[model samples]
Target: MSTFSLDTATVLAAGDASEHRVLIISLFVAFVLATLGITIWAGRQTKDATDFYAGGRSFTGFQNGLAISGDYMSAASFLGIAGAIALFGYDGFLYSIGFLVAWLIALLLVAEPLRNSGRFTMGDVLAFRMRQRPVRTAAGVSTIVVSIFYLLAQMAGAGALVALLLGISSEAGKIAIVILVGIVMILYVAIGGMKGTTWVQMIKAVLLIAGTLLITALVMFKFNWNISSLLGAAAENSGKGAAFLEPGLKYGVDSMTKIDFISLGLALVLGTAGLPHILIRFYTVPTARVARKSVNWAIGIIGGFYLMTIALGFGAAALLKQETIIESNAAGNTAAPLLAQEIGGGAGSAGGAILLAIISAVAFATILAVVAGLTLASSSSFAHDLYVNVIRKGNASEKEEVRAARWSTVGIGGAAIFLGVFARDLNVAFLVALAFAVAASANLPTILYSLFWKRFTTQGALWSIYGGLASSVLLVLFSPVVSGAPSAMFPGVDFQWFPLSNPGLISIPLGFLLGWVGTLVSKEQPNIDKYAELEVRSLTGTHAH
Candidate 1:
């Protein structure tokens, strides 16, 4: 490691707090007002369950693609990954690749079949050939758990991010920010429904992509249009020197760390296709062809954005010192903003204030778009899979189901806000990792088998969902995140027994294994006729549902 004086790092000076606050608040108000207006328009048009849950199947391929980008690129991607790259160098770039590559799974396997079969939620597809109640119940549980876990991280990050951006020192202010986000997200789903949510996501995607492009272009200009020089300077300023440009700094070359890296890779690559929020995006389009086209469009946009992140991350490392970034926020969550302030003009300049405000407001919009998607997925699963089909014996009217979904949105949103206040100290990336592990473990295998397998039984589907969900949760509870040493979440308690923080390596295989074993041991005969019908429909997009 290179010996560099931490105290010598240049600190970006702060401008007038009142000015920054005014700019940020004004931009945020404009975004919220626009989305709320869309919600009102969508609400007036939403007359039944189909419109509320799937935007009346009206979104085009390009429109759904923008919405997908908005829902997928969360604050974690904008802030957390950029910060990691600033602090850890090459390892952070790996995250971008993992996130982008996962679209292949979505495109090649899940998207077409899912759109061809599922109507409202993921359970609709999984339970198509299997016994409805038990399978739907299992899928519903997994959907809720994954969505809530993911939502908690976004909500907590919102609170912390707003507090940092606005210079709000009080804990109460942070809680207020969390509640505000939760309430707005709830309204987006409960009132505007999926049409409103899709429009918000599309608008947010445009703003986010534009903001990232502007920042990246400025960073490139600062380097005088030389990549080699930029990398060299980033190495020199990183204090770790050349090692910062290589791997093994963030995740070392040890055996367990290697396994941890693989586990994380599995979750990231396989998990995107399994996410209920993303899966629901396909239902917004009217045709399987449109759904496939949406994924293709999403791949182009998402891939390009990740490339920009690579630039932004290295830009922060080269232009700003490590110590300065840590001092702003230990987790480096504020690195992107600090970079925005620097490249626009040194801090306190008019250019700096304006650029910082634009990026901050975009980040706030990112959180809202993602949380709304998750809330819709979770509440729709509860209302459609459990309440209407399971409890009411599929006798409930469309209006009743829509009413149940609205109430479920409020309940889930409230729970997320409550949990977020207490979990404000948790790492955003770590929470995201747990959500991914559960999605990959519990949902991916079932979806794949349901779509392709001829002998997949109801028992197998239920076993896979419950087993994968259980293994992921149990392993996380015993992993380093819960307890290990002073830096762990439960520092006072040392109950960590698992070697790795992520459980995808073990849980994913176990999930597939249980599904296989459950199929082999089942006495119930496979319904060949149903399988034939599902296969024909899934392949040809005819008579779906």
Candidate 2:
């Protein structure tokens, strides 16, 4: 193992940055071209709505599982979580735990049932036992909202990650990167659809897991394979001493922070099952058994990856100065890449350039794959759920619906680019946690009620979805995330009053309560026959498409 020195790791000056820029740029270009070529190939085979929306249910269990990992493991996991751990220590590792453990919820509660019930979107499942138009509209609205929030995290991550690699620190430069990423993401969805997107995600997952493992192994090797030694070095390098190993660096500070941690935990744990992109991934497989198998595979892959994050996060702390990491990107999104640079051979060395380029290329792949998935999810919701069912009243041709989805991708991509410029300063992982909170609040309760509650009515679905959606969004709008703090999206203002950064604590329960109460107050009786059929379809897959 190469000896790691703080002096060597911290010397990536302008001269060295310029040296590494060409290699990094080349890798990024190669990755984009390769993925784009795959998309074009997949697009040629996409001959129908089924192909565009669900990849014609063509992927196997292991294949879909790989794609799921690709879709789920965002820059938030690779860049955001590593930065969090490198800076905040124990509190930051909590993100990985929350994200990995979330799959249990998806596996046990959602995967099989969702696959058995839904044809193309979450709207299909929720509208199964309710008034089709109203429920589909609500579900479509919720899907798009949740999806856009998730996309912002990807955009923010891409901007920060790419900005660091290119040595661009200006606001305008980062904004330009965001727009470029958005444009490329739109092309991925518009051209490749689900088939192309899935293939990209699958390839990205392998690269990410392999890249992370390399860093993790090197990190462990640096400390002579001693876990205690690695932690001690990290703590010493962080200048926080023993406190770094304990809680409260960022999250467990006091009563309010502890409560915020709980809210964040709730969002992370409950959010995965309700996430539109993840939920729709379940429909890409051929059977409910395959869906369950895919979740099983994802759990193994994601869980192992999270376990490695312990090393990647702490490794950065052990190797690089806190100030250096903070200076590169205040939110610490660049920690993993810097860590790779150090472990390979810091700064002006040839080894450093190659490793940094590889890790960064993998990270860029993560951002592109995730943004494409989120765009497809939102656009699919609009075209399949809102446009066809609501506006066209199911009279539109398949070709028209698919065409509308392609156009929707362009609009959504533009919106993400505009908002991403403003959110460029926040931590990508934290932003994703907020997206999770919204999904858990708005989508989870309604999904659960529709699946298991026989008494669930159309009013209850709307109240649960819309009420939860509006409340979580409104709370976030006034929360510290958007205003009232130096780290907020709008730092100059001070309008925040909400205590928790994540609204999951209050909004999740509120969604469930509204669903229950709305069911009780509704005059329309529950459709027992439809519920029975849905229940059977969900449980046994007797007649599931």
Candidate 3:
């Protein structure tokens, strides 16, 4: 007989490894079955490209709002941010707040006008006033780039979840998640189209909010419902508590980190309004007004969701105990789940175990819903903008376009999966920041200038998109991901070479400058008057005719 002496920590750590694999597999299988069922149901309604791309433009503001929330509150928002807050304290909360505040930009500036002007993609908004082929082509390329980056981040989160929950190798876990997400998302796009994706997002959004709320409540109950005591205890237990409440000098307090935080905040806030995948969701609504209302609704829900994360973070800190967190890789990401198990008195405890199970399951579902939305956005850009406009000169049949979109979804999903598998050990939070930088740089400048600037021309748009894309990508590659310097990716690199991990501060201005320069260099085309008038009416609801 083998005998093992178990310390309290070891016993706690080893508490119920028996049913974890079974629970994970069962939850995953349930997710697969539900997603497949939705796809099969949605397949029956998909009759043409428009139906597939925009759900026949029939969703209510509330339904679309929920879907938008689902798309926005991804795995990064759920697991990553919670983990960050648990680990870093106040800085993580800053990220959550920054992300939520960006929707204000959407509600006030982009939402109504975006839906009023575009049909399938942001290319439609750009092409509405410029050379159709060039603008659409540029927009398509930008969409693919941004979407792929976003997809990679989401897939990385999914793989990490599987590995953490199931105790599998990251590579193997990534493969399983990729195949599951890719196959499920492809089917949703190919068959159910926009309707299917929207419904999935809606359902998942509800599940996510409920799951998080339940965990938060339970966590508070375990901490005796005393907020001050909880905070004090957490702080006493971990030296990180003081820094966690007040943003660090690097992220929030220090001058240099403050500048970086502000820049990152700007990128996240503005970038949400300009993200191609997110913008496309407006077209799923029945009218521009509905799109406007949808943004308002999304703001409320998303805001509430972020608020709850504060309690969740505190719960992790107060109940999970500091020693357990340090032993579990020093990353706060595991704090919440670990807390759940401990409070439940091990995995054998029915209540805590079930709650943990549900939270993990919801995290997986969150990834699927968000990735499906992204895949649809990227695929539509390829099929409707690139294939139909550039390759076929807008003469392709609806069926042909729909087929192309379906195939493109599969391709993009597969590419994201491959990248996630290869980079399984990489930090996804950084990838998400990169996505925001690209969106802020490439897409936001073009969208904002086109909507508000009367002098904006095709030349300016082209310059802004390409210049922003190039600058952001180059800055990231050289910053840390590629160069193993000192900090996270490049910890030892000279500070002069890369002062900040995020490039939005420098690159966003460069994008604007390039756009202005391009406009000055090119004489205003004769078509500017007509296009500007159309855009004005679209914004103000005045018909020039």
Candidate 4:
């Protein structure tokens, strides 16, 4: 079940690797301290609800753009997608395509309207034209569920990535790393608030882009800047010949596999627009125009980064043996770092150690920044939508609401840590794909309907949120990811009956269907006046919060 094979005694016994371990540890410690300092600095500027939840709406387009990229280019992007390409060949690059194309949906449909309509969380926009209590409650629940799923992937990635680099092969070591990540993320959300978290994300984004750029350059140099050469070598080294460079190696093998590929594609492409953490990021900017710019910048930056992943993935496949990559981490989460080590100068070289340390630190920073954003989004929903808007009927003071959000951060962080330990062996990309499916299913329907549909009612919002949430999670519970397969979280169990590992194809349409049905059947009438006001506000930022 463990991806890491280096235990404490083993590290001590391997005298040469000890130096590499020391270097990695030092870089990790430095990144952590540097990010903490940034958080502490930003925390002082966080004074009230607006500051805590939305960074006082102070960031410019490019700045918030980096933060958004930081949040989006997570372990799934860096580790998971790269690993998928390394292991599955052409099928894996599909993730890169899906993820990059996802931003178009965000830019065209989500970013501006969301920024103009909502003050803080997604619940704000969803509840704008509906019964506040019921809609806010449902939106809050949906947000937390989606955010937690996303958080679990980041935490699981953190555990596997860190343990793989530090040479801690024990299960306990991985669990401990998860706990440490949760604790750090809690501090980022609770103390630094949105401002601190944004700053950390921005810094992490720069580091991640730099690290990836360096590796990509090295990879291209190794292949003499020829894409053809790299692909040929990868195909040869993958042990599957030309098949490795083509489809069906991973997702095109059977009817079920094809459907699963489509499901995963739907999740990755449609999921970005609905992701709670990514949604909340728009609030950090000043205006709807700025939000659009943020998305544009993010698209360019993220697109470039993913394009580099082609080199990273293929380079790893070309250089490292498939069996060794699997032995490093069956999910291939460690392939990026191993590639860095190799390109720097194989295994025992000083250059390899330095490069590994740098790359691992960048990835660790990626994990920390993403988990912070997710924790912030879920906790903000718990406090802003559920506690303040629903339970207190908007009677709570800003200070009290902020306190509730901090507490919620601690609670959600703990849950993520607990869940991450169980999920450490799972593919981070696959786990995140589930989160995307849930978000697309539960949140996206309500959001699009609320913004564009004149007949969208409170009942429709409720049905879409709850129905989508329930079906997605339930389907995943019975899917191959949780049981009935060798890679299942519980490999010994076999209760899975769902065919697709990802629920996007089924759940996403169901969410949209349920919303339309609920609206038609409900007695509650749609509010024309509120819808008009919402439209004006969403389109022009007229009297927006």
Q: Count the backbone clashes (under 3 Å) in each candidate.
A: 0, 0, 12, 1
TM-score of each: 0.95, 0.93, 0.91, 0.94
Give per-residue CA lDDT, model 1, range 419-513, as digits (tens): 98887766534567778888899899999988898899999988899999999989988988778755466678888899887899999999899
For model 4, residues 233-325, the per-residue Cα lDDT tens digits are 999999999999888988888888998888878887888899999999999988888899899999999999989989999999999999887
Model 3 lDDT per residue over 165-193, tens place: 66654555557855666677677776778
| Model 2: per-residue Cα lDDT over 429-459, one tens digit each | 3356556877888798888888999999999
Which segments of candidate 2 are over 4 A away from where they belong? 1-15, 167-176, 421-431
lDDT of 2 at 159: 75
In model 1, which residue pairs have backbone atoms overlapping below 3 Å?
A: none
Candidate 4 colliding pairs: 6-169
Candidate 3 — which residues are off by over 4 angstroms?
Answer: 1-17, 163-167, 170-177, 240-244, 249-254, 329-331, 346-348, 485-496, 524-526, 541-545
lDDT of each: 0.85, 0.84, 0.74, 0.85
Candidate 1 Cα outliers beyond 4 Å, as residue runs: 1-16
In terms of TM-score, which candidate is strongest?
1
How far off is residue 42 in model 2, in Å? 0.7
